[model samples]
Target: MDKEEVLNEKYDEKLDRQDVEGQLELNEEDDSPIEEVRVTVPNTDDPLMPCNTFRMWFLGLLFTAIISFVNQFFYLRQTQISIGYSVVALISLPIGHLMARILPTRQFSLFGTSFSLNPGPFSIKEHVLIGTMTACNTGTAYAVDIVILQKLFYNDEKPFIAGLLLVLTTQITGFALAGALRKFLIRPAHMIWPSTLVTASLFRSLHHSVEREDDVGRMTRMKYFLIVTFGSFVWYWFPGFMFPTLGMIAWICWINPNNLILAQLTGTNGLGIGAIALDWSAASYYVSPLVTPWFAQVNILIGFILVTYIMVPWAYYTDLWGSKKYPILSAGLYKDDGTAYNKSLILTDGIMDPQKYIDYGPMRMDSFFALTYGVGFAGLTATVVHVVLYNGREMLDRWKSARTQNEDIHSRLMRVYPEVPNWWYLSLFILSLGLSFVTCVVWGYMPWWAVLLAMGIAIFFVLPVGVVQAVTNQQPGLNIVTEYVIGYMLPGHAITNVTFKTYGYIVNVQALTFTADLKLGHYMKIPPRIMFMAQVVSTFIAGVINLSTATWLINTRPNICTKEGYPFTCRSTKTFYSASIIWGAVAPDRVFGNKDGALYSPVQWGFLVGALLPIPFWIASKKFPHITWLKYVHWPVLLAATSNMPPALPYFYTNGLFLGFVFMFLLRRYRYSWWSRYNYLTSAAMDSGVAICGLIIFFAIQSWEGEFPYWWGNPEDQDYDHCMLANANYYGEIH
Candidate 1:
């Protein structure tokens, strides 16, 4: 048959399948909740394409290396960019089709089942498997942060084997937990992880062809994606390298160069209240404008304004903790004498010297920095309280109904393959736990009791965090809270403190991340066994590569955390190092305890305040049920707004929230058809384009010792963004 006839036949088959499955029809005017919007056509189990094919593994490894190296490199940079999954999804499509066309398709028997080196045609399942592998590897392993801390800050180099084992164990343990929770997270139709829907759309757009008769808009999503992708790729170069000032427009700082407090409130390097950022890289560092919902973005802005604009400025002007004695915004720990804390003086052989620390007096932080930590404590408590208040009943109902409820279309499609067994997950969990425990005790110098306690913390937080991420697309990180608990318990042991925090915080994050991928796999109808193997194997490979890359960078680069390094200043590792000092070397009791006069004693009350903040909102929602908007006031999300104040520039939130409002709220409401057709496709395109350009710039230009010529566009000044507060006293102190 001709192409048109074949396309018509496939369309007819899809309609017949939808009718047979009793699929729910969706319309633009449908008032049904977003969670209830089902696919127009149910997935069919046909062709039975080979999932664990040679081509799949080959591409998985290739991308695993690229993503791991790129992510590790970016993790150390000032901008702290992560390679998004869309980049992988976009790149993998053409490559998968090419492989299908080129590779041998000879059938072979494996354990009495037939398989092929190449699938009959490039299948969606194969595409998903490759994406899954990419997802598992696209971000730097959490253990690398700890390793960087040990090597760069503490001057202690962990053996390569030990570091690799630690990375593998922590990552796999989380995967095991996700595997155990798959039934609850992956099977439920209502647990529509919003990001996965975007991935699904992208996958279908790439793999499936639409009939011209049924196409609503003259422009296809793929065409729009490619056009936008190429445009973004070209546009990024202007702000990314040549004109650094485009990243952060400190207009107020430039206009009023003499006023310290004014500069502190508005400058990007200071409070970042009135800064305008033109760079997408700076704005989307903390939260992706494309993924977060409008309501969440609004709530985040609310908290951000309250803290940075009002509270921080008021406290600083009032000289709370004598804030005027130091720079208005700095992550650096200070001393009672109003000077930078000399870390070298307090360290002897990479361990804290108690006498030296005592002689050095108490460590002090910038007022804004302390406020960020306070908000973090509040965010942690608010997460648990908010989830329980808003989603607790729904979760319980899901658990009860999961046993007997009729399968949704996606679930029905997934029923073609056997579910992964309980023992498989349990065995992996046990093995991972043992490996982690051994690594902590032997290599990390963590106590056995501490290791168990950290694992217990992960177990307790995983479910709530998972629920929040599955529903809201945001995670209230456990880093600060975990550090507080562990620090208080194991005072003066830096290694133990960091190790505990790593296990407690990263384990939950990894589990949630893995569970999100599982939901993606479920949405795409990939077999559970194949998905699990892909993640496990790819994570291992990526972990090794990440560790190697980190090692190479640290060894080759000198003065990593100094001003001399410019973009390679190791800002992330320095932040992690400071955290270790606060929670490990100094101890929370010393900073926030009821001492005669502790600098940040008042901030400790944030935990209590955070726990109670969500109660009023929950009660208000119940009392005035007609005011539907009240239910969406998420305190955890609000608190998260201030969490990035230290590492991320203030303009990040301002610009990102603006885009979120534009796309998620305005466009979605006023231009529903356009929003539905192209919103996520636009997001995917931008992310892919930016990531590809970043890679090219790093490898081709930056790596070759080439430099953009010094000119007006590329200035030689350090603060090219013009974000520095012009107060002589503060500037001198920092310099």
Candidate 2:
């Protein structure tokens, strides 16, 4: 059947069902096994909707530039604010419609082309395209870190064009891989990227005009979204600005003020045993529980309970790696006397001096930081094994059947538009690879071969990582392991080691993100060609702006990345710089294994543990068919549960999962109609509200001095959560 016929039959069936029943629910007609996608995504398309109109380009470029500029500008700061796509989606809809109404619709001829200045009406396709562009480069590019690190720490000054090229190459290389791997990640019906579903749900809620009788008693999705968003925005002022204690209410710590162990157990910064976060930002920091599947949440919960509650407590109490001396949860590296590790002491001209390194005590970390890295290692291997065991053959079959198989409804609808040719991807991939090689070699960042190795690693791992992300909304990162391999290969080349790691790690991430966006486009029924063009343009714009912004900041602000720079003190970059010193200047073999007082050889066993952990579950799943829960044991997700530790405190998970239980579990099972219709809408609303409120607080209120008076909620001396002792971590005044 033709695309139109497929659309007609499907649309007719749904319309007829609604006409007969008067209140036909989509969840009742959930033929697709993936319930989330079925409820959230519409299996329909308007192929002739003027998606390539000037309105798309204008608004698309506007938001893409704004998002890119804002994100890159704030990236170096201690407290950074990210502007998410939901914000863009929320703001742009009215602007788009307004422009459509205002802009002249007269067709104009330029050169050989004739195009209208405005489309008939604002299209969801146009919105998706706009979002795609912004989504393509939301954060600062991986290579921007390289640029900033070089300028601030290494004092390496390359040409602006070279730095720009480096950023562009690193950022866009993944787009090529995403295009190539679309069959495995995007085409498969089962590969429902959960986050995209939320985005899809948001657009549908905003644009869809009709409402069913079943939705009469319940508020409209858009109305609910707006009310919730406004509520979130208004509510965040307390936690975000005025009453900071509202963010993490550590009531248990308030009960026993002087008790260190109790404080440690209950502190927001510590184990977070009795911590309760009222802040949505804090609540949703690590995991978006509402949109994230219950199975995934359950896996995360299991992993979190095991690692945070059981393993960490055991390791910390036993003083593993002398944990009692440093903070119980910290990402900072340290020395034998419990002072911070000063890489400056052992460095000569930005590279490691072995004799000076010997003079400084071996690199030490608290057991929690050490184990998180171990967990990261475990997560990577488990991802490989887990995907292969569970999804390997199916992926292979899906790959083979791409041409022959009967298409899914969504895929069938998408056939109305032209597909992006494979050569386009191959060509882009080759060009990006060539540029990456050129920039690295020409600018003396690394050897040309190192770039190739990095890209090769990205290609090899993209499918597994993408599959993991598709299934669980969690991607097991290649960052740690990539560093280890490159560090082994090119010892003492700090620049090369980090550059290699970024290329390998961030490229895979970019590919997965692009694939996710593509999946969103698929769900929203955007044309493949338009999606490709939108991403390409946006990536280019975002990359240039990122490099330019970083360059501008480093030049304009002296000592920008150091403490003397004050608020601009590069907190995150310091960690990035530390990683370079650890894995780049000082190779992994020296740093990780038992050597010269260095403590963390056991982290290496995570590789073995991760690889082995999945096999037993697979075996047991096969051995016992009736025991269904055993089959959902995803080691990658579980291992990665504590992946964001050190930065993501235990309370983040505590509150997030509790909310997940209420919404994703209880509401989803009991309140089926409400959950099916409004669940993803609620997630989007919450995120949007939090993001806007955060920006306003940072810029409008908190940016000015003496905005809010200090009170019990916003304490001047003690910890905000009232857990002074636990947050102190035995050391009285450590950040």
Candidate 3:
């Protein structure tokens, strides 16, 4: 029998069962296993739908340039932002439909095959390809930071070609790694990549217009999406611009304005405890409330409470690392004398002056800042431990099955498309490796062995980190660990330290991001080869645009790294530069080793502590299998949650968790029908709205020296939310 005949017979049998008289129907309360409802992948045999069309390429290049420029421009600002993928995915659909209506469908022959510039109709595949292109340019290139560091801090000007090559090499190397892991990561049905489900549902809602009678209670997804998108866009103006204080509401600080301890505990710009941030930008800064599961949110919440409310307060009150002398929450490193550490005083010819350093005294970190590193150390170890304990066997099984197994439903459907050859990925990897090696050795002034070590570190960690991100939509990046390793290996070479850290840490991040995109392609059933080509091409485009944008910003902006710059104060770059001094120039041994014997010296043991932390949870889950909650206790999530103090606002956790519980738990459990239809669409709409409005506000007003007229609504102090705790005397200095 034909496959179609078999499917039809199964469908007819299901209908016949429904038609049976006097049959008892299973209700929601029934304990029996529900019959699996299989959805046939749509348009599997439709070849006329345009995917790799000229229109796609044209629109892709246009959007990639816009998004890349916007993203790179924002990356240098105090509040680093990126264009959301949903913005691109949502915008592309209408543009694609418009092109389909106008473009001619003239066929042409290519390599003995018939093709067309406009293949009969617009396709979801083409929409996804466009999204893929936009997604590549959504984040600032990692190498851009390295180039900025060299120029701004070290005063070393790199040739444009050298910078371009460095960016291309790092970005492409990650893509190659992602491609190599396609069989293990992308070809699995269970690797749901929860985030991609939102995009997939949005695609179906847009392209598949034929609604059934079963969808009677629900509004059209597009209509609902538009309503939410517009509402969010309008709502954001008050919090995002005119009344910026709406983002952070510290009621405790408002009530007790003069109490130093209370202010430190409750202020948004202070320790950020007992605060309620209303803005989506502030609430969603750390994690997306819509996509992250309630269980994960709960775990993160518990960790935040323990760290911020308990650990941080205890250390601060006790004056650990002389916490009472400095602000409780700061990323800045200070001198032991409790004054701000000036880099210029200690630097002689772009390298640390040993005599100047000895005279200046050792650097001291804020109590909370030191604690973040300790927590980060614990998070890193816990990630490895948790993955091995919970997922090792599953990963091993998947690798073994990749050789012969064709069990996954998505994989079986995807077999129709030609696979991207392994040699293609290998060739890209080899070229990227050679180029990166040469750049680092020659321009970066690093030994050949160090470059090789960096690449090796990336390769070793990518798989484990990829597995963690694939299963849980979070990745514990190798940034801290990479710096620690390289610092010890090649001390006093700040440029080489950052260069190594970029390759070692960012390569893994880029690879996981690419793999996620590849999985999105898999879900949408785009051909593998086309996805590969689109990713590589778009990445190259992003490299050029990002470098150009960064160069322009640096050249045009004066006082780029100073206090006078305010919003353009290079906050992120300063943090990066600080890490180089602490880890590379001064050396970790001086801070955490026997020389200091400070409060943070004990933090080095967190690795050993973290390794043992997950064992109890794993054992409990196995021993008490019926206690279901025990299994959900993910140590990595718990440990990682504690490390969000410095960079992220505290209310992000408190607010996002509240929203997640309300949506994922309350709405999902009680209003199943509504939740099923609108949850993901609502998320997509909100993200798209906020992102679109942000770009308009920046480009139209802020970038052109335009500002909202100062009033109570728009404060001149930049503390319109009144979240600043006026207790500068309590902590000697306010960052």
Candidate 4:
């Protein structure tokens, strides 16, 4: 048989079922020429399931968690810091890089299952950074928001078991959320997979380096690592320690006053400061960096303009900021003081009384006034459109493939296109609703009605917002959507009641986002077993550290967890706790339409408008086909947000330009050949080394340096109780 005939026969066999016998018979034909085939062995340089005998991942995760826990402990005590999610990136980037260089080749094989981590022709620098960044991005966010926040709000009363369950639930929820989109995202060609781009860049750079040098010595690599380490170490601290007046103060004003100037100045230090300006950014920086990027996205920046310059100023001028100084009745609501929840008493002569400040700022009497419900309305509209328009076709394709394939019909179909199987989503929605009801009932903190109502509202809207966020990068899932939904539906619930809903919803969203990425990791021949155990262990490690530090500050008197003003407000356990409570319970009143609430900031509203603003131009452009600009309305909003950096614009642009000019122009021109060789490894070495330095700083130096990284505890407080003690108080004794 001819080669083409053989190829055609093989293809036909693939299409047909159980044709091995026929193919063998045909190949055995005496007249047919036997073709000698050469097969290359699959590389097994870095095996995945290395010796199913010993659990390398279990050990790694255990070690990582322990280190994280210990680091967070001192970080909380010294800096009143809680670990941020990005901190994982800070540590992992370096650790992974270093390990990649030093660790022996890992291999695994057991029973019938065998997988190897082959050393690709790529460079070590890229792989190290990719691994480290992955650990950091996924790990720390879970630590700060879920672990610390959970302990802060509920540790006093909930059992350790409950906390564990909550964490697991959050993880599971994240997995389920991402599972639906796994097919579209993980499939080789569909999504651009931006994160992988970062990883690939690092890989290519290292590959170039290896090609340039016959043998990379330990000392040479070490020298390069050290150069980058100390350089970045000093550079990072320059703005934080040397220029605290600007670094710290500007962040404070930006967040509190909703100012942009402070955010711009943050670039002076190369840190993302605009994130601290908004509550969402602050929370998001720890929960998920991908979402936090919105703080600097085109639509978000445009939203900020409308909110700060237009909406907020107008509110201030209109006395909306000063409106209803008399506290309106919370119907029959009463404070912890057992007095009528006097809106008047809370309000000060039609303005929030001068102010009894906490850590972040005064709990403004009219703080809830700035909220707006329109964003949720807009988000819901956009979400439906996105899922149906873009994802709908994909889901149909998955369904078609699943129907013809005999694979576990449910899972395979869901994996390919989860949304197509209406039953699957229906089950998830029902399950989530059921779990939420049980949570409120078991906790007995929120009324049954509140739980049911909150879930109903959340279920109705979370899909649209959550789906939009997961698939195409959109800001529809901003906490504002959940917060407002809760507020609008459950206006009568206490602040804490509302909090439960927000926490549940956000955790659910986060779990899905992270898990989706993990699916990709699994499919790409990355170790699923390792990543899974690593994540689970990392969570508990972060939890223990976060809880201990939070407890310490709560018990610390005077300087600790104060209800006082300015920095104290910033430090108060009550502020974070209260924010969670309000977000979960109040819903629309506090989150959506409340102009005074952070969720309704001019920035948020502006984004809402910008997202929808394109519709009119889109339609008009259709009518006047000659107007090329109208077709590109989205560009202006993105440009506006990009340009909103204020004082930092020159520096940020300069930094990018400097890096570009130096690397692409000067160095490349001078040593064109060497550029390909050194550039990749250089960056990998630099990032990995500095990341290690940063982790050491965080765990060894920063922990002991008298400040915690996140919001663990007040370091200045002289007499704070440890976390174990606080947990004992909350769980052991009836307060």
Best-matching candidate per lDDT? 2
Counting only residues 3 or more apart in sequence or on different chains, how many pairs clash (N, Cα, C under 3 Å) in candidate 3?
1
Query: Where does candidate 3 clash, by residue pair?
Result: 245-721
Ordered from best to worst lDDT, the candidate numbers read 2, 1, 3, 4
Candidate 1, residues 1-735, lDDT tens digits: the string is 854345445654564455444423533322213531343223444425457787788888789888888888878876566777778888787887778667776888989998777654566678878888988877788778888888777778878888888888878888888876766676766677777777777776666555334355468767787898899898899787777777777777877766776676677777676677777777777767767777777788899889977887787778788877777777777776578887777777766666877777778877888988899888888888987888788668777775436456567667777888989989999999898878887885587788788889888878777776676667788888889998888777676788888888888888888899888877666788888888988898899989999889878887776788767887777777777887887778877885423678788889999999999989999999999999889898888887867767667888888888888889888987777777777777777788888778777888676678777556776566564553222444553
For every candidate, C-alpha RMSD to the true structure in Å: 3.4, 4.2, 5.6, 13.9
TM-score of each: 0.92, 0.95, 0.91, 0.56
Model 2 / residue 513 / CA error / Å: 0.7
Off by over 4 Å in 2: 1-31, 404-406, 729-735
Q: Give the TM-score of candidate 1.
A: 0.92
lDDT of model 3 at residue 548? 94
Q: Write the per-residue lDDT of candidate 2 for residues 118-161, one digit (tens) a residue.
A: 74667778888887888777777888888788878887777899
Superposed by TM-score, candidate 2 places the C-alpha of residue 300 at a distance from the truth, in angstroms, of: 0.9
The runs of at least 3 residues in candidate 1 whose Cα sits more than 4 Å from the true structure, single-residue gaps closed, are 1-50, 77-81, 110-113, 212-217, 404-407, 553-569, 594-597, 726-733
Candidate that would win on TM-score = 2
Please provide, for model 3 over 588-631, each residue's C-alpha lDDT reduced to its tens digit, 9 standing for 90 to 100: 77666655433467788878888889999899999999999998
Can you rank all candidates by TM-score, best first?
A: 2, 1, 3, 4
